[model samples]
Target: MNLMFVHDVRSETYNEETFARSYGYKIWEERYLPVFNKINVCFRNKDTNVDLNGISDKSSGPKVFFDKRIGMFKGPDVFFSRRIKNILRENIRNNDAVIVRLDSFLGLQTISECRKINKPYMIELVGCAWDSFWNHGFLGKILAPYLFLKTKIEVKRAPFVVYVTREFLQKRYPTKGISTNISNVKISKQKESDLNGRIEKISRLGNKIILGTAANVDVKYKGQKFVIEALGRLKKQGYTQFEYQILGPGDQRYLLDMARKFGVENQIKLLGSYPHEKVFEWMRNELDVYIQPSLQEGLPRAVIEAMSLGVPCIGSDVAGIPELLDKKWVFSRKKDKANEISKLLKKISKEELKVQAIRNFKTAEEYDYNFLLDKRFKILEKYKDFIRREK
Candidate 1:
């Protein structure tokens, strides 16, 4: 059967020859290719600068196809034109099934078009629109409640819903329709010796402790700032053996400036984004602890990946973070996350780190690739069955 997947995710094209996504392109083939014979993705075009160098990991081999005409239109930041709406109408009319991701301008608009023609579609609820917008800054604070309500109403009426977060997004945006909680994290089993290596690393972590987080520094809600602030608090209390490594794409000037103000400038290392293999290698070799200090999240893939590596992790209490970690390992979601992080980092012992590593690796077993694949396969099978009956 054919599928038309709708999302507002940004993607770039190479002269309409090859395509790439900010999220890896392999995700398409991995998730949809099993049940869907042919998949046509309808997503917003990436209008910003399309750098050619080192784009292979993203553009490697995307099996999904796209409509070049749809790619020509402006993205969600701009107004949706009538011509685009007409194109989407025709696109939906041709496909057997439509899966629209929620909490995006284009996705909501597509839902409107689907409903107008009495078309049946499914929803993918990944994150809370409320936390996303409220933490985005001034104008976002004003629009947060509106978008949150809009998303809630949309999810409430959808015929089928898939939530990435097990509990967080499910509670925030519920549905009376058929729904399932499935996280997007995929991890591989670690060797038993990997835990021994973590314990060995902690034994040697006497004077210096290496900490790291992977996220775009440009997005404030990722909570990179809080880590720096927590380090600052540690410094003020005469603790200065911590080093922070950041890995992701974004302007680091803000974080750098904050690092300097916090008097931990020398401790900060902004290692730009690397391929998945390289990232895992870095975590295994260099990191003493992994931190996901995000103010919001959807069961962050990074944390689970870290867990798979036997790296002790700390995350904010919001969303699915607490679900991944124990209460003591997580800081509160309030404004003083830095304080809570500071206290946790200060009091957490090496023995506790060793214990966390062992426990975390065990927890990660549930997200093993084969296990998740079987789970998602069943979900997609249900989706296909439901769509065929409705259409």
Candidate 2:
């Protein structure tokens, strides 16, 4: 069937080119691309400066333009552009199914247009957008209620909502709509030789890599500052061998200041984003532990990738993390941050670490290509019947 996959946010599609080069865009290119006969993905291309040619079966449309100087007023432009694109695409395909990954301003427009046109569309709630904005202090307190209301209205209009995290399912997913929890997709196994080479390079940089977390450092909700603080505490306890690597790009100056303020600048490595393949290779080969300290998340793709490589993860017991990981690996959501870090570190004896790694790998296998693909395809297939019944 023809499928129009709308990626309203460009950052979601090509923000990290370096990482994508090394590992390839396996999540979308491999996992979701084959399900449909044809697919069109729309995304922003300006900031990412990425060529979407090889990433998907079809090219991504132009970036949504907005007046940065005007700020809030820029919303309508995006909303209309997205709606126009969906309407045009829907007309071209006649009676194709559409899936909108609503992480952009255009999503609201697309949803509205779909309703007006009586199109069969599904919304993918990758995460709680409202919470993500509020946690980062981006969506001001004054506007939060309005944003929540807007989201609630849009979500309710969709016939099907796919949530990546259980937190989203419990807190925000509409009870009246048909909702499904489908966690992040995983990459298939790569060559062991490649994985080893990547690991060696990362290990050669330090003796004991205590913790690692990767994200656009500028996004405050990622909780990068908390990880830095935890690193400082580890150092005070004489864990000098430990090092933390912050991957991805965005506001390096701010991150540097944070590291210096924590007095752990020397222990933190700011690896500006690498190609996707190399990033995955490095994760598979070099990283000893993966930590997701995000204040909020839907289901982080990075965490799932790390687990697939047998890297034990220590993430905040928030959102969908607890659903993905075992109870033991999760740190208390309300515990003292430093104490939680200490507790996780204390559990990693060499033997226990190996066992945990294996367990993580096994858990990750459940989200592998075959498993996720089957589930997703089944959902798509069911959509055909649901649409007919709706008519």
Candidate 3:
């Protein structure tokens, strides 16, 4: 059976094989390929530059439908054109089952088309479009309302709904369907066991904690500024043993400028983007405290990765963050994140950190790929009849 995956995640090339080698391998291996014999991914044309340093050049992966005209905002010309809609309709008609990654402009259109044709499709609620309103630019602010409403309707109409954050997305977009909470983080049992040893090592390390987070610095909603300010507050209060290390691809000028403004420039280091293996290595060996103070989130994978490495985490009390962290480890994103975080930094002891790290390691084990793959396999078992139906 062929699976139709509708999303706007663009890759560099249009060649099916090259595209899969670069971007589609993981989804194919972990999510779609296990269930479907073949997958037909409908995605937008290449638009932005992505880091290609670590992507493997392998031949095994998914079928691609690189829609040249479909994208986030294709201007007035593409919006009124029937060709994009026709292309989506054609793609949807050829597949046995549909999986729409919601909140994308093209994906919503495909889901709407699926509804019109009465094709059974599952909705993967990964991120919320409505929560991103304040972060958008002038034109994006204008388009956000339409996208939010479109996503809301599409989710409810979907026969199956899987959310990265169970409580967060469910509350915002309620659906009466076969629903399940499935996170995308995929650690292994061996790695979890290794992390227990790492926690023991961390407990032996001295003071001068390294607080770190991984996120694109360009996005304002990530609350990078808040983390910096919290560090500044900690420094001002005579606590000078910690440093903030951020990893990810983005312009660091804003964060640098904020660090300078707060007079905590020396305490912050922007490590930039690293490969997944390197990131895990760094988290395990280098980082002492993991921080996820995002103003909003859909269950951050970075925080979970840090936890899996036996690093104690402090995250903002929003979305799925609270679900992963204990109440004491959680700080308010709006009200007193800086104060709460600074307070926690001062009060948290080494023994407490070790205990919390072990607790977190246990929590992160549930999201391991081995477990999630089985969970997903069982979930898809009920939909086998729908997935295997002929066109």
What is the lDDT of every predicted structure here? 0.80, 0.64, 0.74
Residue-wise C-alpha lDDT for candidate 2, range 85-175, written one tens digit per residue: 5454554255367677754455655666677767878888776656565675644454456656776777776777777765654477574
lDDT of 3 by residue, 46-144 (tens): 543543535422223445344444544453233455888888888788878778876677767777687788888888787788766545667667877
TM-score of 3: 0.86
Summarize candidate 1's per-residue lDDT along 106-191 as a digit string, tens digits.
Answer: 78778888899888888888778888889988877987888889889999999889898878888888899888877777666668
Off by over 4 Å in 3: 14-24, 45-51, 55-83, 135-146, 190-193, 387-391
Clashes of each: 0, 15, 0
Best candidate according to lDDT: 1
**In model 2, where do residues sit more than 4 Å from their true spots?**
11-37, 47-95, 138-140, 166-171, 175-177, 189-207, 333-335, 385-391
How much lDDT does candidate 2 score? 0.64
Off by over 4 Å in 1: 15-22, 47-56, 59-62, 67-80
Q: How many clashes does the backbone of model 2 have?
A: 15
